[model samples]
Structures are given as structure tokens and as C-alpha cells.
Target: MSPKYTLSLWICCCTLFISCSANQPSEERSDYPEADSLIQAALSEDLFTGAVLLIAESGEIVHHKAYGYATLYDESLRVVPSPDSTTTRHLFDLASLTKVFATTYAFMALHTDGKINPDAPVSQYLPDFNTPQHRTITVRQLLNHTSGLMPWYPLYYRAAGSDDLIKEILSLPLSGVPGEARRYSDLGFIVLAEIAESITGMSFDEYLYDRVYSRIGLEKTVYNPLDKGMEDLVSTSHGNPFERKMVYEPDFGYRIDVDPDSWRNWRTYTLRGEVSDGNAWHAAGGMAGHAGLFSTAEDLLLLLQAVINPVSGSNDPIFEEETIRMFTEPDEFGNGLGWAMEPSALHAETLPQGAIGHTGFTGTNFVADPNPDGGRIYILLTNRQHVGVDGAGLYPDLRELREKMAKLVFGEQLR
Candidate 1:
């Protein structure tokens, strides 16, 4: 492989491909025709430059395919002279999916070992949430997105380091009353990580790997894949332009209360192997509970097997059925501890009722149809940011594609 370069993200407009068929023929056929067609349509629409899809039924891989280029365009959008074809092995930023496989799984592991209690106050684990405003919040509520925490904030702008970031997050006022509403708060998950760290006395990632991942057969599933000698990852986004816009442009819709000028540091380069989330990269230093995980569909399936089928392949099940169900069964709030219960955007209409799943920014998804007899695990990993955002300064939305995938995987099950 030729040496890769990390060039300025906003440098140039890449050679615009009219469609994903620019390098490959759209007429190509695969065993999984519906999935192939869906991805091809998405690629033509510039949903992403590359993607990998894997479907496993009862822990058995049924259909696994890769599409498009791993590094189709450079930071400036100029087409790469020799872009690498995406493969199942290439890691894609799992984004918010990290909340499930890494952080949520961390919670499940702790619960299984009797080291943690979902009903317990988070303040008991991390003093950061001990304030009266956050005192009533429970660990389960954080997992359920009912902690009343705001959906997001750019804490990196205000904090000096990870510790300060945690403090700042816990210090923030709530968006609603705790346990009374469901607000998907990344800060809540960040606090969840703080709780995990305080209990384990290890870095969040280290503890997760030690307690759960290491026990299972997840090799490529990891935090900071770049430092682990994983350089050939699917590219994601042209720098943090979208995040910057969120701060600099009030109407961008993120609407953080802080001044945009507060944070001087910004990444101006295209990302590869590096995390795509501003919080995970800038504030949490490449690893956090809410985001910043990298993995391939192949490796993630191993995790699915352990969580769903109780078949760890080469190891013991990561969590018992009871523990897994506690985290997978969503309450009235439509959240299962760390997982999102079925009927969510990804699992809606097609997946079995009460199944568990999660979606990621940067175009990734993990869903499992938790049928008692047999289940299918659906994973779609894409580099939605590789081609850069459209005129609206937004990455292409893959929710429609995600929904289609679930429908494709569960044809007659659609509601």
C-alpha cells in the first residue's frame, strides 16, 4: 500500500462521482440482491463512499458483503489516485454504537458480576453526579435515556481534560425531570463511563475489554483502532466541519448554550481510523462511552452471537440470559438499559418486537431480531462522511437505508 496522508479536510472539491458506479459497475450482482441494490442506490445518492453489511442468523453468518472504496476521496474530495476497495476487515467508526457494545456492555458485565446495580443512584458510583440536580438519577435511567440530561453539548470547548469534561457534564442542568422523560443524552452515557471507571479502577475501554470483550471473540472491535496498527479503516467525514457549524451557526440546530469562540482547537483533516465524534476525539481523547468505537461487521457479529445466542464461538457467553435481557428489553421508554428496543428507527416495522439494537453516527447500525427459535443480527457499516456533507452541511442520512435493511432481513415480519 502507498503511504497514506492526512491532508487538510477543507482543501479542495474532490472529483465528483455522478454515482457509486463511478469505479464499479452498478449492474454487478450479489447473492444478497436486495441488500446490494439498497447499498448501490445509497452510494449513487452519495450516502457514503463505502460500506459493509453482514447478516447472521442464529450466530451463523448468512450474508456478508462489502461495497465501494474505503478511501475514495481525499480531504478535499479529490478522488484518490488509487483508492482502496472496502473490505469486511476495514474498521468503520461505530460512533454511538459504542454506547451499546462498549459502554452498555460494560454496564451489563458489571451487573452480571453483581458489582453494579441498575436501580442504584449514579452518584453512588461517581461523585460527579452527587449534586441535588443529578442526585435522583439512577444508572438504569441513564441507560434508558430518562436521566433528563440534554441530548448533547460541546464539553471539549470548556474542559481542560477528561476529568474536567466529566465534571462539566455532570454539572450541566437537566433538560427535563429525571425518570419522567426519555432524552437521549450523550452526556448521560459519558457519566455512565465515569461510573464504570470509578468502580473498575481502569480506563473505561480497558475495563470493558477486560470484563466483557476479552472473554468473547471480538478482535477487531476496539477503541482507537489506529494505534492498534489498524490504518486501513474506512474514511469518515472531512474534519469536524459539521460540529464546527453546530457551534458557529446558531441555526445549525445543535444550539449549545456556550460561546462558539470558546474552543480554539479544531481538526481540519479528513479522518481515517481516528474517531469521528468531537466529544470522543477532542474531549474524551479518542475513547468515550457515548462514541468512539471502531470495528468491522465481521467482528461485531461475534459480539452479537455472545449477546444473543449465548454462543461465544471460542469463549464463554459474555453475559447470562438474564443480564442480557435486562439490557435488551426496553421499558415503556423504548430503551433497554443501553440498547434501544425494537421499533426504533433501525428496527422499526420489520424487526421482531422488543428486539434490541442501536445506530451510530458516521453511518453504522447494529440490530438483532430476538426471536426465540432463531434470530438474525443485522449490521451495516458505512463511511457517510467520506464524501463530505452536502450543500446543507450535513452528512447523508442513512436511516431510510437502515430501515430498508431491516425490512430486507425480515421480509414478512414488517408491521
Candidate 2:
């Protein structure tokens, strides 16, 4: 054959190979197509404004995809989101995941350092936590959500600030005796944060950064994202309308109302770069144990990856293997220390029996096995509440979208 003809033939062969490879299902995408499809479906339904979905298996990232808009509007301009207009780098309110990432990790540090006892009563460190009913609430009980504290109270409405809030929480009566039952409680983690402060002589955010984040290679994870000038942060809710109504409306009698959803007045202003949880923002001033922490999905996945591998993967391990085990192990309620274990909705329908994870109220969640060898991690971060709480009321099934995502990822392995 002539030299030109041979070169042309080689070029044609290369083009055909490229086309075939492009059409082939990626080996890296085992269950990712189903998972990505689920995310797209959720985005189409406006289940969330935007999301950063990441999946890793056997210590390698198999999938990392960003979707939808970081913000649908700019001031007054309704901008259509594209790759240039939107990014996965936007910070999201981690909400309750702060329990594990900040509060729980702080406690684990305190426990490892012998600075605090897990079994010790809260009163041991905080003697003013001397409410008769709360004297028996141990640190372990708080960590495990067995402290019998209510899941939440509108302390932001009742108290002027953190000082008064702590006073109110310490004095509040327990709904049940300590260790009698497991009830997931923000109040418990708030108290845990307080306990951490009492022990370290530093604020929660300061202590968390010094002890956990600063050392863990998590530079972007932070509290008070607005203070850090993170203006592009993913927006949540329309100015906490439900909370404003509960706090401000005179018909509610200027008291903490029991039913949050059954209220009259609601705010319409957009809540961007603000902590969505009322108590965390208003009462604690955007620094709390249970909520307030904000981070990117990439930052969170770094932390999660460390938690899974713990030993040699990161330059500094977040926790020792034993401590990690203790935290991820199942409790009576199938909740791990700060993490949720098997049978929790966060773990999806049919994940491995020992998979552990946690979900944030702001549509953030990460479920991981952390077995090192065959471990899998799935993370979804979105500003779902941006559509307003009322949207969920109209579209009640919207909340189940995470579980559906999990089911899709796990496929037939889900129980």
C-alpha cells in the first residue's frame, strides 16, 4: 500500500475504536447510570435546586458529577444554570451532619485525649447542668441520642442568645429518663458542644478547627460560611419562613409553639449564605454542635474517606481504628456514635448490613461501608429546602428521594 493510504487506514481504525469506546458502558459506572438518572429525575422535579453527587469504591472515586443550579437567580435576574453559571464547589449547610463531623469528632478527640469521660454525667463537667432530671444524662447517652432530650425546641425564639439558650437547655426537663430510650436530639448535641467548650476553654468552632478540621486536611469545611465570605454558598429555604412565623407571629402567643408546620405567618425573602436552622443561626450565632457547619461535597468526601480508611490514606487520621469502630458500631436504636448504622433510611433499602451514614435536614447525606477493601461511599448534597417547606407539603414524596437514590445505587443488594 502507498504511505498515504496506510496512514489514512490507521486514522480510520483509531476513529472507529474511539467511537466504540464512547458508546460502551463505562466499567467505572457499575450502578452509576441508575444513580445519575435518579439525580436527574430529582432535579427535574425540583426536589432540590442543585446537587453534588459523589461515589467512591475500593478507595477510588468511581463517579463525581454536579447537577442543576447553584442559584437559579442573581439578585433579581433568573439565570439559567450551566457549567459556567453553576459549580459543585458551592458550599452547603451540613445541618445535622455537624453532629458527626464537628460535635462527635470533638467528643472523640476529648475521649481519646482522656480529657473527658464518655460515661461521666454531663453535670460532672457542667455542674450548672444541674437540672434534677438531666443529672443522669451521661456523655455516652448524649452521643448515642439516649439522653431523653427532645429532638428540638425553639430556643432561638425563647432565648436571646447562646448564654440564655444554654441556661434554658440545662434547666429544661427531660422527656424521659436518661438511657431509657433513644431519641435523636439536636438539644443533646448542643449540650455536647457546650460540654466540649467547658472542657477545652474554647468555642465550638475554634475547638473543632484546632482539633479536627485543621489537622484533617479539610480546609473548606467551616462554620459561619458567610463570615468566611462564601457568597456563592448554596441557598436553603426562603429566610427560614417557618421559623420566623413560629417566632414572630402574635397569634402564636410569643411562645415556642409545638407544631412548626401549622402556622400563619411565613417569610418570603431568600435565605442565602445563612444557617437554615433557627437555633443554630439566631441562638448560637451560626456556631452550634447540631447544625451550622457548612462545607463542599468534596471537603465532606475527604472527611468521609478518612473515616473509612483512617490508617494510611490521609496524612493524619481523624480517629484511631478503635475509635472509628466505636463510632460506627450500631447502638440499640441502630444508630452509631454520631453515625447511623444499618436499618436507617440513610443507608438506603438494601446496602450492606453494616453500612453506616447520616443525613442532614438540608438534603445532605453520606452513606459508607468504610471496610477499606470493598467499601463504598455515596454522597448527595443539595439545597432541597430552597423550594420552601410548603413545596414538600404539596409534594410529600419529595423527602423520599434520598432513599430512592440509595435504592438505585444499591440496586438488588438493598434490603
Candidate 3:
């Protein structure tokens, strides 16, 4: 062959090989058309400033996507300075992921060691927790949020200190009979934290660090980054949606980098390196059994993996196989231990059986279905509170997005 012709043929062969390799499906690619569309839709609506959404089935992460910026320049615009790379780790507020990792994990550790009993009354550990109607409240009731306690109370403003806070929380009257109905209550979990501390002879935070977080190999998951040698990497939050514009004058909260110190005061408090929930933070951002956990998407996925397949890890199982089953399954009120269970197809024509997970108020959610042939797990972490705390409507959008993504990956609708 002529030298020019030989070279041309060699180049064409290399190009063909590259094209074939690019088109070849690696293990990572699983069908997820809905996931891609949902993420793009969330970005378009500004419903989430940034998010890390992942789906795993049969012990593999089938889909992973990162969208938007860690911080926003405007309500609809992303920050100019992106991470070191597109895949760089972004610190998410974690909102209520704290309940699963901090609260539920603490309960499991104590239960596994025989340090605490699920059926024991709260007054057994917290003597001051006694009430005529609430005397029947048990550890299990608290964990399942069926203790008939009020959903939430602003004990932070009413109480002077930690002791006062506990007293005030216990003093509140019950809304209904214990276990009569399912009422999601943060107060129940707050008392549960106290019970864990009283029985274990260690603070909830210390107990978790010693038994759960460290053992689980979660390097970045913590109650408060300020106390964990993580002064940096904490994101600042706007006090209200309009603080950036009206309250702070022209700065509009978004125009300039937030000055953490200026807004650290009690009023217009900007949450940075501190717990956002006032009641939970007042408890020192420890394992509150209700709120106060901060983590990244990767760290949370590790915890979920343990929950879904406990046999794969060397660390002790957080809950026994039976206990895990009980915790993840629906109870009398369609909720489980720290999780909300979806109804079976027979019970609710639109619902799916064995679909269990929890959503955090701070814009975090983890859902998992563990049927051997049809299991799926998803984690969506966002700082929806970045704008402020009032617009809870974003949760519905999140739910819809998750449902759509799940359908795309699992080929079955969640509801």
C-alpha cells in the first residue's frame, strides 16, 4: 500500500475502536430515563439549589447524578465558583437524616447490647418524665412516634437551659392516648435521647460517636461540625428568603458571601457550623434522637447500605435481622421505627408494599425497598432551607421527583 493510504487506514481503525468502546455498556449504566428528567426539572424550577441523588439496587449504585451549585448567586442562578471538579464532595445540611443516623442508630446500638428495652417506659430512665397520661409512653412508642406526644414545641425559647428544656418538654400535656393514633412527634424523640443518655451513663452524642458513627466508618457525619474539628466546610444559610434583600439592605443575602459572625446573634441568626433547629441545637447538637445530624450524600449511602444489607459489613449490625424487619415494616399507623411505611397494594390501591424510608425537614430523604427481586434505594440531599425554612411545599416536589426516578429505575411506580 502507499504510505498515505496506510496512514489513513490506521487512523480510521483507531477511530472505529474508540467509537465502539464509547458505545459499550459498562456495569454502571442501568436504565434511568426518569431520573435524568426529574433532576433537570428540579434544576429548572430552582426547587433545589444543589442535590446528590443516587439509586442502588442489588448492592450496586445504578444511577448517580449531581445538579446545580452548592450555593446560589440568585434564586434562579448558580454560584460562579464551582467545586474543584464536578464530582467533588459537597457538604449537605442533612436536615433530618439526623433521625436515622443519630437517633435510630443510637436506639439500635443500645437495644443490641441489652442496655435498653424497647417496651420499657420512659419514666424508668427519666424520672422527671412522669405524667398522668404519658406514664404509658414506652421507648418503642417514642421510636415509632406513636407516644401521642405533641409533634413539636419551641422549648428553646421557653426554657432557660438544658435541664429547664427537659422539664418543659415533659410538662407539656399529651394530645391523645399513647399508641392510639400515629402522630409524628419530635418531642417523643427528644425525650428518647434523654432516656438513652440516662440509661447508658453517657451523653447521646458521646454514645453515638463511641458506638455508632466511628464504628460505621462515617468520617464526616456528625451532630455539629463546629465541635468535630470541621470549622471549615460548613455552608451558611439565609435567615429568611428575603433577608438577602429586605432585612440586610441591598446585599439581598445572595449578592455577597455571608459573614458568619454578624448573623450569629440570636435574632436573624444565620446557621453556619451550628444546628439549624433551635430545640435540637440547644441540646448541643448531640444525638437528639429527633434532629441534629449533618452528613454528605456518600456518608449517608454508607449507612443505608448497612440497613439494606447488614451482612456485608464487618461492623456490628445496628439492629438484629428480626428487629430490622420490624423497624422497616408498617405498624398500626402505617409507620415503623423512625420510618414511614407505605401501605400494601390491598390496603391502599395506589401504594406499594414494603416501601419504607424517611424525609428530613431540612430537605433530605432516603427511601429503600428490600424485596430480593425488586429492591431499590434512593438518597436525595439538598439544602432547600438555604432560602429559608417556611416554604415546606418543596417537599411535595421532592416526593414527586423521587417517585418518578424510582419508576424509571425499578419499572414500578412507588404509589
Tens-digit lDDT track of model 1 for 51-108? 8888777666777777777888877888778777776667899999999888888888
Candidate 3 per-residue lDDT over residues 256-317, each given as its tens digit: 22343344334354455566566676544334667777776667777776677776755557
Off by over 4 Å in 3: 1-33, 73-88, 231-237, 240-270, 283-287, 313-316, 343-352, 372-374, 388-397, 412-415
Error of 3 at 50 (Å): 0.5
Superposition TM-score, candidate 1 onto the true structure: 0.90
| Number of the candidate with higher lDDT, 1 or 3 | 1
Ranking by TM-score: 1, 2, 3
Screening candidate 3 with a backbone cut-off below 3 angstroms (N, C-alpha, C), the clashing residue pairs are 244-252, 244-253, 245-252
Candidate 2, number of clashes: 4
Sorted on lDDT, highest at the top, how do the candidates line up? Answer: 1, 2, 3
Give the lowest summed-lDDT range of ten residues in model 1.
9-18
The best candidate by TM-score is 1
